[model samples]
Target: MASKFQGFPGMDDILPGEIEKWQWVEERARAFFEAGGFKEIRTPILEPTELFVRSIGQSSDIVHKEMFSFKDRGERDMTMRPEMTASVARAVIERGLLTQAKSLRLYYVGPMFRAERPQAGRKRQFHQIGAEIINENEASDFDAIALVHGLLHYTGLKEFSLNLNDLGDEESRKKVKTALADYFEKEKNRLCKDCRWRLEKNVLRIFDCKIAECQPVIEKAPWEQFAPLGANFRKLTAKLADYGIPCKVNRRLVRGLDYYNGVVFEITASGLGAQNAVAGGGRYDNLYQDLGGAAVPCTGFSIGFERLLTAIQAQDEKAFEEIRTRRVYLAPLEDCAAVLNVVRETALRLREKGFRIEMSPGVFSLSQHLKKADKLGARYALIAGLDEVSRGKLVVKDLAKREQAEIEPEKITACFEQ
Candidate 1:
């Protein structure tokens, strides 16, 4: 039965069993980022609305249509972050991290808010695992791409495709925008109302349109003639090939955000239908300057944590078996005070030694404890009863093997170690 009162519509509670999967990925991501000279950064979820307005562009969908914005008690306009890049730039500049480091390699893991019509693998409040290389050269675009590639690969995704594109520098993008406006304008009658509005607003946004009616006019647009994947990108692809990183050029891969300039790319994994892109990003060299900072060359990418996990689960059935079955179920076989004390002490000690212990709040019968342990897929049950506690010993039962052994109080950790 559903609860009479439920959580707000796009928010979800990441309950216990499922939350372990999230933790595993988060741990792996932290290790990988730290190893690559990246440090973690956390910023508040709320920021001044103008931060996004200035950085993501006034014409972008995130600013105009999707942002969750409101005026605060003091009448200051604030917004729940719709994306991280703008917020990151705000943080790096505000905190003087800019002066502290010549080049900053930073990573973030957290939730982002966007008002979107929800669908499979897409959420209104979705989480992201992303990294940025600030003040690095153009080659850092490739570095950011390769980092995400290696990250997804590390998470055990065997089959995924990389689609690359070059949005060019500021000077080239204006030319592309003008050419796109002229071409999209000729076919204005064929465009959806949004595309027509976008044509005058930000012509590049037309490529982001998903309406079935606009495909014909958009497909024939002269993207290459106006903004061809330039020679510099040719060198990037060749370098990728030299290192055996597979990629294919996609002229239409211009990303949604407006601050993006220079190279842009998207990575797609199979099993996700139309929304197959699991991760995407590119260079946005001007974003810092847009948010009241010095000109900082930067490249970064963000992976949809939900979408990437779904892709991994679709291909592997036993995806989180190890995380599931490794916990020790602490069983107070008898509800006596002494037995409870022994079980509590043992649980704390095991947890201190880095073992996950599952201890129920209420006491259960011996048979009930065993059943609960099996139901949770617990590998072992640490049993303490009046008799065992009186003898200063405990019974460790291997739930899977149907085996039991007696160990002294001091030897319980060693028993589980075996």
Candidate 2:
């Protein structure tokens, strides 16, 4: 009665009933990326352990606490990729893709592993749809942000806000980091344990701490004094405004990653509560050189696939209805070989016409098959019985209309073409 095994905690299985939403989101993402001239790139799920440490920063949460790292048979350190930017950089450099083009526009859809406490939108193994634009300038930063805005809009997410921040250039970041470190050190006792540890190692990460005790100290940190807004940052905001994309400038928004510099952004949707960030990313100019490639400027963003679906479902229930309709159910009444062939061929032809077809197995009775079709939300059911097979005809029943008609095998697909 009880199962012998269970899935790992925080690792969820996307069951059949729920996976349609995922597919819908993924399809829209792929089409959007392709239209924007971003070629798809898939990197290995695992990378050298040092890659993350070097790119994501050792003091960051992903590298310090959340990474799934271990050694292999040869005792070489390896890690399951917690995020994709590092892996994408490694691929471009290793494959010499950058050598062939002046710039690279690539997108990826896959799972990222992070050993985080699972909540509604967070998971140990989660999927992301992201893109990277390498060897581009500050204008490309605007492009990257706008692209994410457009994609989220395409998903039919209505109530969302785009919060933008500039981490400043490298020199400004160094000054701010030092200022934050010194300021947080004085208030170290008042900070959380994690913030206390980050105070010395990577002080910017303290802003990422969501602990209530640390919020007061983080809010008072001297961000404007050290990293004052620059001209380019103003221009980015102006451009976004010009395009009619509403955004709020958040000086405290230093994204969790250390590699991000210049511009950073996060898009949060309403109704998802505290973990409402559906998408976020910014510029990482030095990542290429840091990972053993030529100096290149890159900007990109990743949409949390699960969170996007949640927001869509909450806002628009009808979005899922489109995928539920136009499905065909095939019911084979006779268990004989000839009837099976006819059922199989008919289903195959219908599928070729771009219809979702579900075939009933041999053991199901005609009544049971009809029940299954209804359960699947199919609009039409094609019943193939001995009499219909002998007459080279199949019974097409419009489940929604409660009507049935005998049509020749060739006319079966034509019945639903309208």
Candidate 3:
């Protein structure tokens, strides 16, 4: 029969086999971030609507079109955050984290909500692992980029490219915005409906439009002539080269967020096709002041957790093997109370040693139990029968080697250790 209900579109249920990959990625990220002196911070999934409007900018796609905003019964405007930077900024300011220290280094992994057309690797409710460095200078921008580069390298992804750009300071951005608006207005008739709207709202966003007809008009819009790179931006590129990090300067790499002011970047892997950007971030120097806090310079980046996993699975065949090591299947052949007791004790002892043991309930012959063990991908099968229980011994069968040995019950764990 058909199910009476269905999951919301763009929302996914991560099943058992697939969830192992997510855990593996999370474990590696936690180790990497902690070693870098970045503490983990988790902000609420919902925030006051004005927070995003002030921080992300009212004209950006996240605030204007994609935000999941609603009014509570208390009549307060609220929104589910589409990204974490704005929320992180609010947390630092509201909690006075920076007052105690000159700077704060933090990392986060969680779900974000956005209302948009969903496709492969893009979901309404997606997960991200990101870091934020607040009250730091231009060097922090390079630090953020290097952190992301190190993370992808740790994940074992071989085929990917990093694209970097500098949006310049606020004054340079203002001049570029005016020039872009003037130029786009002249060719407004040739632009897409969305680009036409963006022209009046945020002219720089037109570069993000993927509409085929808007491509030529966007390509010839004179990006370099308007948003020129400064000395600091050039210094960042030189430092990256000194570190031997391969990065291409893309003059058109304005990220989809409005808050980013200087040095933005994106890393796209091979297997993800058109939606290949596994990670991206940049500096948002003025966001704190915009959100009613002291002026602070900050830089950070976030990796699309789902896209990173997809890339890893495509590249590494044994990616999940670490999670599957030393798994055992325990098969109880008799229904007697004594045999069950022995089975329980053996399973518990094996578990204490960090072995994953699956116990078979009810009665099954030895051959049938071995079949079940193979089906579960168990490396070994521990058989407990009435005779073995009485003798305080169990049959340990190595499924991979096709060998069996009668061993004392206490030695079962040690046998696998070998």
Error of 2 at 86 (Å): 0.5
- What does candidate 2's lDDT look like per residue over 1-418, in tens digits? 9999999888999997787678777887898999999999999998999999999999999999999999999999999999999999999999999889999999999999999998888999999999999999988988999999999999778889999888988888888888878898889899988888888789888888999998998899877888888899899899889999999989889888889999999999986888999999999999989988899999999999888888987887786776655588988888898888888888888877756787655657778988999998888888988988998989998888899999987777877887
What TM-score, over all chains together, does every model reach? Answer: 0.92, 0.91, 0.87
* Model 2, CA-based lDDT: 0.89
Across residues 1-418, which tens digit of lDDT does each residue of candidate 1 receive? 9889987667778998888788888988998999998999998999999999988888788887998999999999999999898888999999989799899999999999998777787678999999989999898877998899999988777789999989888999999989889898889999999989888889998888999999999899888899877787899899899888999988887788999998899999987888999999999999898887999999999999988888888878787676654589988877678888778888888876656788777878889988888888788898888888898989988887899989986787876776
Candidate 2 is scored at a TM of 0.91
What would the per-residue lDDT of candidate 3 be over residues 1-418, giving only the tens digit for each residue?
9999999999899996577568677878988999999999999999999999988877788888998999999999999999999999999999999989999999999999999889998899999999999999998988999999999888767778999998989998999999989998999999999888899889888888888999998888898888778888899889999999989999888999889998999999988878999999999999999888988999999999999988877777776676566688988889989988888888899988767776566789999999888887888898989998898889998888899999988888888787
Ten contiguous residues minimizing lDDT sum, candidate 1: 317-326
Query: Weakest 10 consecutive residues, lDDT, candidate 2?
Result: 354-363
How far residue 331's Cα lies from its native spot in candidate 1, in Å, is 1.7
Q: How accurate is candidate 1 locally (lDDT)?
A: 0.87
- How big is the positional error of residue 341 in model 3, measured in Å on the Cα after superposition? 9.6
